[model samples]
Target: MGRGPSIEGRKNAADAQKAKKFTKFIREITIAARVGGGDPIANPRLRLAIDKALTANMTKDTIERALKRGTGEGATEQVVEIRYEGYGPGGVAVMVDCMTDNPTRTVADVRAAFSRNGGNLGTSGSVAFQFTKTGEIIFDIRETPALEEKIMEVALEAGADDVLSEDGFIDVLTSPDSYLGVKAAFEKAGLAPIDSDVVMRPATRAALDGEAAAQMNKLIARLEELDDVQDVHHNADLPA
Candidate 1:
């Protein structure tokens, strides 16, 4: 499947966002390789991580450098991958995925963001129980006949759990075990998706509106401003 066409309305904002997002993607690759080894052939997670960077238009030079850093063949600096759990405003559960050279500084920055936003950072496993980590892949939605059928067949054949076409893309859910397989199959079929990541899936979602939603959105914005914060996942229903 191919993207139908670019949406002029959001292209500028998306371009701006991709600049920072690509940085995070690179960080993720570096850390993923560090923890799991630099060879994507031997590391499934790293393979997926690289695919994510590519999806965001990360250049090959940038990615190879990250891998070299991870493997210690190019750099000796320490880069760590850390996950933080917290409660945001309105009792919304949040999972922050981070990459940093200094965990101490990272923690302080995260704590301050939470405090200033009326949220509380919890212990290692405190808020994690509220959500499950799942593989989520999105395809750039296209206008074509037999669209859903095409996506469903590819996803299911590769062990996807479900397929939902909404928000202009087909979202394929899979157990982490099959993520790379599904991704590879789709790539071979010439369907490039927008994004894929291990996301926090809340068991139940809380609906937010009016001032509460506004506050939550603000909190998210502030959290993202922190460079250490790579990906922030929440289970609140709010409109973009």
Candidate 2:
């Protein structure tokens, strides 16, 4: 018998999502290499980008090509980083980080996504004050005092700001500058984080439910669907 249609559709969607993620990683790597250098040891930003790509299962050859493109060997266009701030449904603060070769096209797409989804794009710094930029490292481990103590001991010793146990994960927060050192420390100690990133964490969350929560989710999905949108940060407290 043939596979279920729903299963096949899910597989296709997953594949598409993975491809999009790879494209974003490549762009980030190329930009990082271009701004800094191809040597990961010498360039912290590029090093982090490459690490993320590797963790995502990006192939070595693909990474090398991105590095070469960044180094201008086969690069076609210059990509620039642009941040768009806005308010989504339920007064939730939203920030969109993008790397694009064309600012005009990116901005238009971003604005349209916001407007069509019950949102309004705002000027720079408008909603930025609502967030704090920090490095977050999350470990998927059962909550235990012993493990929590171990994580705190290692992370704090490595300049981490704080450690928190949330839901089914342990979160280590760090200053942006201390992120690389802290991560290295964890790795050296044989503690591998399931996910880590420098992100704009919302200082406050806007709780929403029913229609507002649904609208907020839709807005975020729309924003993330944009090819130029690399990351979407929001302060919405919706149901999981």
Candidate 3:
């Protein structure tokens, strides 16, 4: 019954979200360059981070600045990467990856998010065994026998582990080590992926509905809203 958000308010929210995304991208780029080298050609991690930044429409100059900060050519903040494993509503396994300057604050905030959302924080390795790290590339194309065959041929030849067609999308799964190579092969073959990433895939999913599902969604949203949280992975299968 009340008035909805005005256009300016919506625009402001969108702009803020974009800024947050860019900040996260820059942080990832800086860390990758710092861990590896500034040269994308030589540093696979940095190369992937650069690709993501470009795909997100990030400016080259901004990326260069982040690289400089990483390589010590410019001032940089000291941030630590941490992983937190937990369980959300309906006993769904959850994993969170974060980069933060304050570990104490980050942990406290994460724990609170879980507690407030009918979940609880877990010790390291508690929920990690439920997942496997793998690379996944998804193409937003209508499923067809011929198209599936072509995609499978290309992906397999590129060293992908498997190709699957379902729900009008094509999936190319690969080992972590072969992810970059497979992605490059797809690009050369003019197959652009709508989404691709190396992620922690859950082996099993917990089905939730009604109140539990709502709580799980809130838990995820809360974790994502934390400034230091980077990635959130879960094994909750909720109704659409």
TM-scores of the models, in the order given:
0.82, 0.90, 0.93
Error of 2 at 115 (Å): 1.5
* lDDT (10s digit) by residue, model 3, range 1-240: 899999999999999999999999888999988999899988977987888889889999999999999898999899878999999998899999999999999999999999999999999999999999989999877744456666788899999998878888898999977888999898998888889998898898899999999999999999999999989999999899
Q: What lDDT does each candidate get?
A: 0.82, 0.90, 0.91
State which candidate has the highest lDDT.
Answer: 3
Question: What value of lDDT does candidate 1 attain over all alpha carbons?
Answer: 0.82
Q: Write the per-residue lDDT of candidate 2 for residues 71-139, one digit (tens) a residue.
A: 988855778999999999867899999999899999999999989888899999999999998999999
Query: Model 1, residue 12: displacement in angstroms?
Result: 12
Q: Is candidate 1 or candidate 2 better by TM-score?
A: 2
Higher-ranked by lDDT: 2 or 3: 3
lDDT of 1 by residue, 15-55 (tens): 87887888787777887788889989888778878877887
Span of 10 residues, lowest total lDDT, candidate 3: 141-150
